[model samples]
Target: MTVALWCILIAFLLPYLCTYVAKISGGFRLKDNHDPRDFLDSLNGLGRRAYAAQLNGFEVTPAFAAAVIVAHLAGNAELVTIDVMAVLFITSRLLYIICYLVDWAILRSLVWLVGMGLIVGLFVVSA
Candidate 1:
């Protein structure tokens, strides 16, 4: 239950926090930059990726939590397994965001695939 709550919080907060981090580090300020367009573009890109990852997390949590909760209600909750998968999913997404930010082509793609597989695995195993 706690994990689920944390997952929800992280899922929601990661994007906002990541965007803020990127914006501040990318020269964001109260005043507009000399080239406002470029600054906006940079911020937009960072925000987009953060949003994409957040969407992925959102997609996973409901299904994952529902499966785990339903199973528990039915006397078959594999709490540890669900928790492990949840942790893995979150960690992999963090790795993914880093890789995406750095433009690490190969490693990013590999981790992306693994992250997808992990989500699929959650569904598969839950059933």
Candidate 2:
């Protein structure tokens, strides 16, 4: 599998990390009947961000994975193009999580844009 595929695997698990963080935060009880939205409110600091990041991670995963798979199989782009975009996408995602946890709003948005661009680049350069 390509590094991009490996990154997709890693991305698959990123949300669980955020969930673990949410549990460690004030919203530790996974069994509660509370709405998921309220769980975020219960968290005061990094915890809230963790929950938000988890949701965001989920939001991005499908598109990323689809793009990676389709691009890998159908893309006529140079291997270097594929590889570079893949690595950068992963790097941006990891950085995005950190930026979320640290509450770096502007930076996180920029990083997200970078990630999104990489995804689009992957698709565009693919056949």
Number of the predicted model whose TM-score against the real structure is largest? 2
Model 2 ranges with Cα > 4 A deviation: 27-41
Clashes of 2: 0
Task: Tell me which residue pairs clash in candidate 1.
Answer: none
- The residue-by-residue lDDT of candidate 1 on 1-127, one tens digit each, is 5574466456555555555555565677667656543664554455555545555555555654554455445544366766676677677778877876665758877887876776567656656
lDDT of 1 at 70: 51
Decoy 2 TM-score against native: 0.86
**RMSD, one per candidate, in order:** 4.6, 2.5
lDDT of each: 0.61, 0.85
TM-score of each: 0.66, 0.86
How many clashes does each candidate structure show, in the order listed?
0, 0
